[model samples]
Target: MLLSPTFSILLLQAASSLAIPGSVVKRADPVVQLDDTTVTGIANGTVNQFLGIPFAQPPVGSLRFQLPRPLPSYNESFPATAYGPVCPQQAFNLTIPSDLPAETQEVLEVMNSGSTRTISEDCLSLNVIAPANASVGSKHPVIVWIFGGGFEAGDPAATDGSVIVNKSIDLGVPVVYVSINYRTKVLITLAFGFLAGKEVQEAGIGNLGLQDQRLALKWIQRYIGQFGGDPSKVTIWGESAGAISVALQMVTNSGNAEGLFRAAFMQSGSPIPVGDIAHGQVYYDSLVNQTGCSNSSDTLKCLRGVPYDTLMDAVNNTPNIFSYQSLSLAWLPRVDGIFLTDDPQQLVLQGSVADVPFVTGDCNDEGTIFSFANLNVTTDDEFLTYIQMYYTPGASVDEVKQILDLYPQDPADGSPFNTSDQNALTPQSKRLAAFQGDAIFQGPRRSFLQQRAGKQETWSFCNKQSKALPYLGSYHGSDMESIWGDGAMSDYFLRFVTNLDPNGNTSINWPRYTLDSPNMLTLLDGSIPLQITQDDYRVEAMRGVSGLMLKYPL
Candidate 1:
């Protein structure tokens, strides 16, 4: 029998109430007694006493690439009052444009400044926040957030859930907010290197980062009820690579956390083709060659013996590591025949996904952040050369002419194309942006929705607000403003999290997406409020790209 949304919701509700068979005692401050560490936090009129807890054993030294071991049972209460260390990452320096206003500049400075922001391998931890009046029977819905940094960089602590938590409390719908950390960079993707010649692949090797997330969910299932959250009503949310992870969890059977989570929110990340075992083998060989671990000794052991900094240096020295246009990075989830059995896009096409309610969308200018590398284009000829060289491989002169004809150049006017094209591009740039956006984001999004449309409950959105930034044009990570907004948007996210709807009673009709007539929720500027429309150009482009994907299955 086919899975039904009603059945899924009911199952989750039932799972939330499941407790230790006969324990009946309830407490007002259950977290204080249950966790060894606890600290109070206040922001935006809401008070959150947090508990820092370990969900798994530290993946250090010998356990580096192995599956996560369950956290040791602590007999005494532990203090989880402060944020834990961030996962290891290469130091990144982002330059704020001189055109930014002083206030915006200050905000950006605070967002990026900190010597403590340096990466470390010893960074697997979780943070929990609850309302001041949190109790056992309050049964607040829980949101487990996973941050995104292209599987390379990000910190759970960087995102402040105070706004969302505060808004939830004010609306009489309290929520427990959680942010978790997992291994990053080489630690995550290099597991494939260790699997060579092994008969059975370990659970953590190819996608240990994902395994870490699942372990955290299991911990939530076992302990969240004691902290005023309904364990069964957990919702997993993420952006960028985090969003891709969410999509992975939805499709992978290993992601079946039983009754832990019921809903998912994916922002700016969708499942694309992942590397296959054969391709993974190539990456593993490259790592071996770069690190001088070519000896007959166990490759995994040799890798573990190398100093963390040395390994990082080797990764940095590699040519074109994150050059997405050339697809050179090796640190991505792989189809290792274990946690991930098949490509996610193919799974979606076959309607093989967890039949749960989903809220998914992309920022207006997702491509712009990536297009920074192509900024040297000063003329139409330069732009066309880039397209022929990077986008379509082995295209002859005739094909290039056809593509140019299809997307003509207008030297007179410049307008940014897609959500990120606000600075004005030549007509040729606009067309290139559309094609690139389709190949990278919009196409995948449409294909994902179409595959899941008739099978599950789906909601779609397009965030189209510039918010004080002139040229950004709602680029990547903009919807974060709504989810963790300063005021109004925060309230909207709170309402949506507690009750599967974001609009208040007086709000306009917000309909669910359907396969026959897909409608998208547009969050635009002005007092116009939310609106819906059905334009399937992105979807059509995806169908063509999907055909191309068959030729090059990652």
Candidate 2:
């Protein structure tokens, strides 16, 4: 008996569902029923597990590139055991050569690990891990985590919340932990073009990825009570791009302030300069041309009609690194008149940001991690030339030479005859590292502190301990080891997350950052911690550059 066409299609769908990992097994629990659809998770003696819970409707077919719409509540219980599909992303698993520097190899190895490689477009789901013993009325403080990938790649499923959950239990906090995934790549940026027109833009809103995050927060506010969490006491935390998103949420007033989050923990990323709609329009037009879509009255209709794979391929082909190799593509939150009213730096300067407690800092050697991207400089002449080419492009040749002299290269550094060996020591690397570090990380952090010091509680630190294979003095992302426990730095993070303080009555006294007397806690080598009375010379240098750059409008 041959099946009919409709029956054949249904059979194929059922077979596909069975082929995929349907859901995770649930531990026995009295609180929730142990059905095939629901799974139970136990961590630190607490049993709770939620999987495949939809915060928004699927962005497929007609909805592609449009703002996410809220998922309708299902009358029947839905399976939420396994994580939902990851949002589409380009693979970032570039192989490092065996003979590369140990620090470079180590950093690359960690980044290319299994946890980072498994990314997909269908990954717009979130997970929650709470104490098993938590009752409905527990009202524990909730921590909502947003992962970072330079606004390109990352998923909440990559991080395991067991450690944070256990530490929270140990500290008698019994908190709930939530992690979410947002849209990325072209899906994030191309949406920005719709901000110009009113009618069409309303239907196909820009910043759909951010809108996804806002919807997730709304879900937490509505459903967190079921998981024994206090929605009013939620703390938004993220690293890199995730941190920047958290900062945007705090500053924006687009219905995000309905008692959603009370505090914020921004790790590495902050609101720096992002491309405006005027600048972004060029990229949008380029994408439209690449796709060969019709420029009809319904531009979004034509864009949405394009094949997903075709659009994704275009995005992957787009060059992310700059031509001169000075900076990565600045695809971040823009001042879209909605989420962002003005530049974050300006907002911070004017004390316009919400007066929430902020804890921010950076790794000691951020630029060192990005050393491979630097244009190799062998001599003081070449070093100055490189700076002039990349940094002071608009200045006259003589003016560029003068600026180079102002920040001259060191005398004794050796030159690399060939480009491959340009990894050799040069004053260029040191100066670039200092300039990039200050301009990108340290200066912005200082500016944030200066503006928020007297008005809000702020804490800052400079992580210096390195677990680099050859020890590169705590380069970029070393602080993650402290939070995730891949290295010795985990204990401090455990203390910080669980107790809301990194220092737990230890010998080291972690002081709060203030405007008049700004002190930074230095995480040094060995067991002894160091405190710098005044700002470091590198910081001062960067501050000077930051001041100079501020003179010109961004």
TM-score of every model? 0.80, 0.80
**Residue by residue across 147-209, what tens digits does model 2's lDDT show?**
765555555665666557766676565778898877864434223212223333345365666
Cα shift from native, residue 119, model 1 (Å)? 3.5
Backbone clash count for every predicted candidate, in the order shown: 18, 17
Name the Cα RMSD for model 1: 8.8
Model 1, span 340-434: residue lDDT tens:
78777776766667777887887665554444334455466776676556554445555555445444454212113343434543334445444
For model 2, give the RMSD to the true fold. Answer: 9.2
Model 1 segments more than 4 A misplaced:
1-31, 35-45, 93-115, 186-204, 254-257, 280-283, 319-329, 376-415, 418-432, 467-471, 486-492, 503-506
